[model samples]
Structure formats: structure tokens, C-alpha cells
Target: MLLRFTTLSALFFAYTLAWAQQSNSLFFMHRIPQSNLINPAVQIDCPVYVGVPFLSSLHLNLNSTGYSYNDIANGTGTINFPALVGQMHSWDYLSEELHYTPVSFGFMYDNDQYFNFAWTERVESKLFVSKRLMSLFANGNTQYVGNGLVTSNPGLNSFYYREFSFGYSTRLRGDVLVGAHAKILFGLAGLYTKRNSVDIEIDALTHNINARWNPQVNVAYPIGVTTDAAGNVTGVSAGAFSPLPFSLNFSNPGLAFDLGFVKPNDPITWSGSILDLGFIWWLKSTSRFTNDGHFVYRGATPADLTNPDAYIDMLADSINNQVQFQHSNGSFVSFLNPKAYFGGTYAFTPQLLAGAHVRTEWYPGRPVVGLTLSAIAMAKKGSSVSLTYSVMNGSFANIGAAFNIGGESFQFYILADNLLAPFYPERVRNANLRFGFNLFWGCKQKKKKLSIPESSGGGCFWTWGLDQKRKQHGVK
Candidate 1:
């Protein structure tokens, strides 16, 4: 029975790893308007810009704290479970997230203030697993006969939602730029664990299994539930399938805010931001599933072990008969994962700069921190490229890169935290990509003064303006 439970947990863990979250490479690329998503104070030089509807901005992220795909699969394309389990830490996590912007636009006001609006759809999921549980799955329970096993509660959290945000930024005293984003969120579906105290213990002498499983899981999804005469949940069924299960839902609403500031001092600059500090209340189609108390089972006999198929069926029957699920409808609150950033940059020249950034992401457990160093080069035509190196999530080989290319009227850009993941996915533990297209207008460029010498004829020789001199000198 424990083995069966472990198997199901492993499957769910794999499913969550398919998608992941967030991109740090976009933080330093100020040439792209999307950079403001991370730091609202980041100002785009253009006076006005509009995203190209669905093609505007799309982001996808996938990562694992324990191991990469290569760690499990061998050259012959077979899984090495023991090797995979050996490389796992005491607690490992798999996370996935996606963000898509269908509508977005921004404009600068009076060369001092900026305003923008966007509507985005987001999906995020995470799973936490313990090393002991994985070991039992890889190696059998017999190895842990003498030394019993105790594991922390393994849980999963997933949700889908939509966000409509309005942002404003203005220059403060001493040219300090400050900004904020007020967001309204509508949650569509979610599966969250409210309480978990599920533990399994094996007796050293008698080989008896004692399991104390009392978990409360809250779900807000569109599905039908089956119940018995006594109101106990018997089964769940999905009547019809939809490609996008939670397309739009307004029943669960919430509010969030982001605050940021940028301070410029001569050739050096400082910036900081706090993002997504808010929560959502799940109220529609919400249900809670929970169990009662403890259950004990004797070790499997020799004959039962020999016929594994029969033993599995017997175990299933035993579990169904002993463990009863109680279902109830109730509303619950879920908080958004918040992130903080603090960084500074040094200008080497008019078109080149170097920067260092520190980011911390807060979760229910421990906060994940990362350090990134980047070098950026900009062109006069509103184009730029950046290269970065980051250290985070216990994996150090993070080489990030970003580029923006286009004239003043249109632009296309791509930013990635780990470019190597696409080629050698099995070798890297982190991967994220953000790409978009936008139309830009009224990009202001600084006008340089021309130094012309006076002729011997006196008074003032005929001299052209800076713009005319640039044309005569073949300057762009």
C-alpha cells in the first residue's frame, strides 16, 4: 500500500516538472518594454508602444531542485532509478509556470511620468518530495525493515488565474524614478493542501505497518463528485474534456501590488523592487477532501509477495475499506508567491554598462536567493544585447543572454536565463524563456552640439545645425 502511494506521488511530481517559472535575464534589458514587468520603475526610452496582441509576450519556465533529466536517463534511453535517488537531497522540489500577455500598451507622459496597462494569464504548479520517500520507491521496503522511515509531509500546489494591471511611474526629487502596479486577479482553478500529517511507520520486530494519514486538500475545479448514502465521497468524474479547463472565471477575485524605484547618480545607478504581494480567495466550485485517523496492516506473506498483481488488488481493497474520505464545500485563501530584487549598475560609456542583481523568491518553506552579473551594450537605434551569469537553486552553470533588435517603429526581443538547457536539456537544472513583439513610436534621442570654427572673414562663418552636420559627415 505504501509503495502504491509512492508511485502515484512520483507520477504527480513528474507532471509538475513539465512547466516552470520566472526569468531573471529580462531584468537588465531596459530596451524592451516588457522589462517593466519585473521592475515597474524601469523606464523605456520610447514615448509610446503597443504589444501585438497574442504575439506580444509569452513566458515559460521549468526547473527542478533535485536532479535534471540526464541524471535519470542513461545513454541507452533507460531510467536508472537508483542513480537518480542517490543524487536527491533531503527535500527536493519541482516547479512549473507560464505567463501570456494578450493585451498590453504603455506611454510616457510629459517626459517625466509613464503609464501602462496589461492583461495576463498565468499558471503555476509545484511539488515537494522527500528523499526517504524516493528511496522507498527506488529500493524496496525490506531494506528499511530494521530502521523505520519517517518523512515530512509531501504536498502539491497548483492554480490558474488572470491579472489586469495598471502601472504608473514618475520622476521624484533628484531624478529618482518611483513606480507601482495595482493588479486585480481572478482565480479560475486551484488545488491546495490546507493540512497534512500523513506518516507511515514500519515495526522493526513484527513488520507491522502503522500509518497515520489525515490530510485536508482544498480544490476549486469543474468536476462531478460521487457520494454514498451517508454523504461520503466515493469517486470523482470528469464529464467532458476541454483543452483549456479554466479559461475565464470571476468568482474568485483578489488584489495585488508591486512597488519599485530607480535612483541615478552620475555614472552609477541603483534600483529595487517588490512584486506580487497579495492573495486570492477561492470561493466557486470549492471542495475540501479529508480523512479520519490511523490504520494498521500486517506485512505481506510470502505467497502474497510472489503474486504481486494479486497482492496489489488486496492492498487496494484493504485501503478502500479502512480509509473513508469526507467531502465538504468551503472557501479558502491562497497567497501569491512574492519576489524581491535589489541591484545597481555602472555605466562604462554612453552605450555600454555593467550591472549586478540580487533576487529572493519567498515560498511557504525557505526563500530562494540568486545573484546575477551582467554586461549590456546598446545602440543608437533602440537595440541592445546582454550577457549574464547567475547562481541559484544549487546549480551554478547558469549562463543567461538577451537581445533586442529593430528600428524605432517596431521591435522583437528574446530573453533566456539558461540558453544551454535547450541544447543539452538533460545536463542543466534550470530553463526559462521570454519573447515578444511590440510597436514603438516617438523614441527620443539626445541631440549633440556641433563645434564649428569661425572663418577669417569675421562676424560668423556660415555653419550648419547639428542635424545638418551629421548628414554632411555621414553620421547615423
Candidate 2:
């Protein structure tokens, strides 16, 4: 069981390290309609906008708090296990986030209010593990003969869901613009652990092992499990069961909300938001598995030290014989990872601005935070270019750039948090990218000021002055 779980985690970590999350680059691009995903208070210049189906927005992010690829692998395509283990913290996390919007549209109403709708699909995954637990698996228990090993709160939380959102933004007193998104969520699949604990001790003289395991896991996926007569799970088959596709899963429902505000004051603008405050009660095709077992193994002898394979096989068999899992159908609840943003911008000119942004995401174990500073240049035709420097996920080499190019009828934009990650993948810990296309209409520009008439050539001003003087003197 330990080997299988470790292998699966390692594979997932490796796969997600190459892909990438909420992008800091997009947070400050107010001209892009999709920027509302980060801060709903952001209002696009166009009076009406529609997102291209399936191509409006795509977001992907991958991050690790423990070690990067370079710390584990050498230049010669060899993995250095000891080096990787040495760089790990007491507790580490690996996370993946994805968002794709299929349909979205917005229109201005009452001249001061905006209303929008969107259908989005999202996936989130996070894995937390203990360093000592990893060391116990990698280096063996010989070093811990008397003390043994104890690990707590090591587990995985992953889920897939769809969101149908209705949003509104309106101007308030003091020229403050406030907005919110009310979302209805449908869960498709999930895997979560409520409790996970492991304790093991070996006698100093006899090397006898005493172990206790208490783990409870909940699953809501489409699969069939095979169990032995003793109620121990032995195998799993995916082809044995069929379920509705993710797009059609409405049995598991939830709700969420996002609130934000933007305050503009001449050259300075302030903005903040709180997003994804919600939970899903999973009641469809859910199963709960729990195992609480304590056992002793007195089969180890001094002679078995020379043959490590035989000793490992003996230990595995003892565990299998002692531990049995209890399974039942039950409902579970999982919460969405919430995030917050606080930021401000300074406009040096009508066409140029500088901004600083702070973002935080609350996960299970710890909160992840990032800071970004950016400069944006806007064109009169509603196009923009931005460059940014960000410090995120323990990586300092993040240099980002974005561009929005289009005319009155259509727009296309691409935003990324770490443009260098693809080229220098070994040096960075995380990467994110968002891109989309949209159709726009009734784009309004800054109204131009009317020029004053010259006094020397003013034919109407002289007559107006003479008429005012005659009226003051009572001579009509």
C-alpha cells in the first residue's frame, strides 16, 4: 500500500510540474473582459462583449512547495533521490489548478450597471505529505530502530466541477464600482481524505515491529472495486462501471460567490476582491473507506538483514494480513479553495499606467502568496501591452508579458505569469497562462475636450458681451 501510494503521488507530481494557475499577469489587465475572473469590479470599455465558444479563456497552473525539477534530476537524465530528499521541508505541497470558460456574455444596462453570464469548468488538486514519512520509505527503518516513525495529516484533495455564474457590477457613491458573481456549482468527481495517521516502532534488541494505521478516504468517481472475502480491497477496474460525463453531472450541487470593488481617484485606482467562497455536498456515487488496525510482526531475524528483498516481502505480507478496510456508501462535502486580492495602480498618462498587486490563496496546510509589479501601455484603438515582474511560489525568476490586440469588433489577448519557465524549466517552481478571444461592440473612448474660440476672431462673443452690457444699463 505504501509503495503504491508513493508511486502514484510521484507520477502526479512529475506530470503537473510541466504544466501550470490564477495568473498574476491577468489580474492587472483591466482592458481584457476576462480579467473579471480575478476581480469582478473590472469593467471593460466596450458596452457589449461576447466570448468565443470554448476559446474565450483557458487557465492552467502547477506548483510545488518542496523541490523543483533541477533539485531532483541531474543534467544527464538521472534522478538523485538523496539530494531531492535533503531539500524537502517538514511538510510540502503539490498543487494543480485549471479553468476553462465555454460560454460568456456581458452587456451594459442603465448606463451605470453591467450584467454578465458565464459557464466555466474547473479542476483543482492538492497533495500534502510529510518529509519523515518519505524518508522512512526511501532509507528504510534501520536508522529508526527504537524511535520508529509517526506521521499525521498527509493526504490528497482533488475534484472536478462546473460553474454557472451570473454577475453584476454598478457604480456606487464616491465613484466606487462594486461587483459580484453568484455561482451555482455541479461536482463531477472527487477524492478526499478526512484523516490519515501512521505510527510504527521497532524493538531495539529483537527488531520486532509494532504498527498502527488509521486512514479514512472518500471517493466519488466512476469505478468498480474488487474486495476479498476478508473485506480488504484487492483490485479496482475502471471498465466495470459507467457514469454520466462531467458535463451532465448535476446530482452534486453547490453555491459560491465572489465580491470585489474598484475605486478610481484621478491618477490612482484601488481594487480588491475575495473569490470562491463556497462548498459542494457530494451525494452521488460516493464511497467512504476506513481502516484502523494495529498489528505486530515478530517474523524478522538477524539473518534476513543480508537479504533485503525477503525482509521487505515478509513485512508487506504481515501488513496485508493484519489490515482490513471497511467500506460504505456515504455523502461528503468539499470546499473550494478561496483566494484574495489587493492591488492598486497609478496612471502617469491617459495611455500608460503602473501597478502593484498582492494575491493570496488559502489551501489546506498553508497559504500561498505572491506580489507583482507591472507597467502597461494602452493605445487609442483599445489595444494594450504589459510587462511584469513577480515573486511567487519561492521563484524569483518570473518575468511576465502580455498583449491585447484588436479593433472595434473583436479582441484577442494572452497573459502569462512566467514566460521563462518553458525555456528554463529547471529554474522555476511554477507557471501560469491565460489566453482568449472575444467579440465586442459599442466600445467607448475618452471624450475629447472642445477647444475655446480665439478672442480676436470671435464674432459671437462680441455680440454676447454687447448684449449683456445693454441689459445691465436697462437699454434693450
Candidate 3:
């Protein structure tokens, strides 16, 4: 049975791959709106900074859904278009509508650390904003009449959402830095439709079906179909696709926060740099809100029971009630619970920094080491280019570079990660490129001189707090 399941999954994935080729408007990522969770510290100088930069990054995310007890026995088949199940009356009346989309394009600006040297102690902060578009696709096996076997058929199309987010961060003293971000997400941007289309295939029959089956599949499910007063399908309806279990036209607004610290020291013989440690946690993400209300079936005549429309109402109520489609109520919900990732950076030299990060969720499971690498660079004090080659886990490797325009008064920088799109430190080669740039302007003041007894450092530790007496008598 496991072998059979694996074979089915393989076929589904392959079908998805082929189907993806035809989907031009599908979103490929879901983490776009929450990219600030990666690295919050973008260079923090004296506030105002700007630079023109473009980047692209691509990665693949796989999730398991739609596998109910029935799916286990009949082969996993979940429908993306509720209208298909509605038209065919295939859904069992009491199951929540399942929505599952795989792959999306994730990209962000300002996903790094910003070191501040303007204050007494160097200040640091992280800032970022990003968005991802998710693709809408369905995978499952279809059972034909007169056939005891099932075959996997994956359908992919232009279903997706757009997200916008902004984050800010800054350091406390020289050790603690805190940051947070909020996002506004708008979903279901691409609408598609397919109806009354059929394709007949002449192939070797694996299942023993002597009769021809309707191979017509709808590409986009229409939102509201033409229906009689009693809610029976009256004709093909047209408009925003409806009965699509998930609401695409809703907005989700949520917030996330990050706190990190680094203890810098001149331990041993290392100079100009020290060890840096940090930890980050993300609160539960908010989900798009939609109407849970159902459509009420209306009939004027008492004989509506046998009027066809009445019976359709009964089915609609059963299926519609059982399967709740998410609505666009302009509100929000929550997706995953709180999660966290911890990491550390050790600078062995002014031009070389090494670090590793581990990710864990509150749920019981092994903590996964996302990445580790040593960053190396060569340059003078005013200008330098650094490269970091890192591996997440043991398989994926990524090469990143950051160039700085440094001086006494101010500084400027540009960075590129996954200079190859989508391929990050964790993934060998993903599609999409990720890049960012920043500018900093600051002025440092010279340390002030204080008159005190040579025997005591400035003032006695306790006497410095005595105000008038300490100022008049000094450290006598």
C-alpha cells in the first residue's frame, strides 16, 4: 500500500510539473509577506537611506493536504474548483472544503543586518519587506465508471494572491536589537474559467471501461451560476469564480516581531571583531477573513419539493453547510502557530564572519539546522567586497556578496543573495534572485574629558551618583 501511495504521489507531482507549464499567472510562494522573519537587521545608520536595487529568488514548498480516510482508500484526489464537485455533486455533504496550492514566488527588500557605529556602542537593526504570489493547483486521482482502479490527474491554473509588508528594527545599547513588521495581503488576483469542453483520448484501456467517460474539465469555476429561485442549476453562470472553497478577494493584516542580541568581546587574539549571537521568533500569522454565511434557498410555491429546485436546495444545503468556502470579509484569521529560529555569527576577522542558524517550531520535532557558513572579504577600510558561501543542513549551498562604500562621515552598501533567483543557502538551485542595497549617514562625536583625581577613574563609582557633593569635593 505504501508503494502504491508513493507511486500515486510521484505521478501527481509529475502531472503537477506538466500542468504548471501551462499556468502563467500562478503564484509560486506563500512566504513573501513574511520575509522579515528571515533576517531583520539591514544596515542601520542615521535613519534616512535609499538605493535602487532589483532581485529575484525562487524556492519550492511542498505540503500535504486533502488526504482523508476516504482519500487514503480511493487514492488522494482533492478538487481545486468547488464548481466541479458542485456540478458533479461529488463532495460528501459534511467535509470542510480543502484548499491546497503548491509553489509560489517569494521575494523581499532589506533582508539583512545593518550595523550602526554612530553611537557610543555600535547600534544594529534589521528591516525588510517582501511579497509572494501563490499558485492554485489541485492533485488527486479520478475514478472512472466501471473501473475499479484510479489514476492521478493534477490540475494547475492561474490562482494566486499579492502581499505587501514593511518591517523595522534597531539595537538597545550594544547587545539587544528588536524589530517588527506588519503586512497587508490581498489574495485571489487571477481568475480563470473552463466549461463545456471535452477531450477524448484513444489509449490502451487499463481499467476495463467499455463506455466513454466525460473528460471535459473546467479550468476556472464561475462564482455564481444561473439558478432557479429554488437554487437549482439553471444555466452556465459568469463572473468572479465562486464556490471556490478559499476566498481570493480578501485582505489579511498581521504583525510579527523579532529580538536579537550579540555579545562582542576581544577574547584571545581576535581583533576588530567578535562573536555575535541572535534569536528570532514569529507570532502566529493572520489569515484572510471570509464570510461563513451560506446562501439561502428561496422558493415561492408550496409544490417546490418535487419542483427539482427544492431537491437541489436540500443537496446545496447539505454540501454547502458541510463544506464552508472562505469568504472575502475584509478581515483576518491565523494560519500557523508561533514558531522560532535561533542563530549565531562569529567574526574571526574584520573581513571574515562565520555563523549558523537553527529553526524549530513549538510542536514536538527535531530542530533543523537551516544553514551555516563563513563569509570572507578583502578590501581597504573605505571599500571592500565580501563573499559568503554557506550550507544549510548538509546539502544546499549559496554564495552571497556585499560591497560597502565606507568613510569616516558616512557609508553605503549593496548586497546580493541567491544572486541566483530562488536558490538560497538551503536549496541548491531554486529559481528567483534576491538582492538589496542600503545607505547610511552618521556623525561621531569625540569622547568628552573629565577632571578627577589620578587615583580614581573619573569619579568614585558610588560618589558619581551624589550630585552636588561629588561635583564640589571631587574624589577627596
Give the TM-score of each candidate: 0.86, 0.86, 0.38
Off by over 4 Å in 1: 1-5, 11-21, 76-78, 136-152, 239-248, 444-476
Q: Sort every candidate by lDDT, greatest first.
A: 2, 1, 3
Model 2 ranges off by over 4 Å? 7-18, 138-150, 199-211, 239-246, 295-302, 444-476
- lDDT of all predictions, in order shown? 0.75, 0.75, 0.27
Model 3 residue 143 lDDT score: 34
Error of 2 at 355 (Å): 1.3
Each candidate's number of clashing pairs is: 4, 5, 44
Q: Tell me the tens digit of each residue's lDDT in model 2 across 283-350.
A: 98888888877878785567999898989988788777777777778999998889999998787665
Candidate 3 positional error at 162, Å: 6.2
RMSD of 3: 17.5
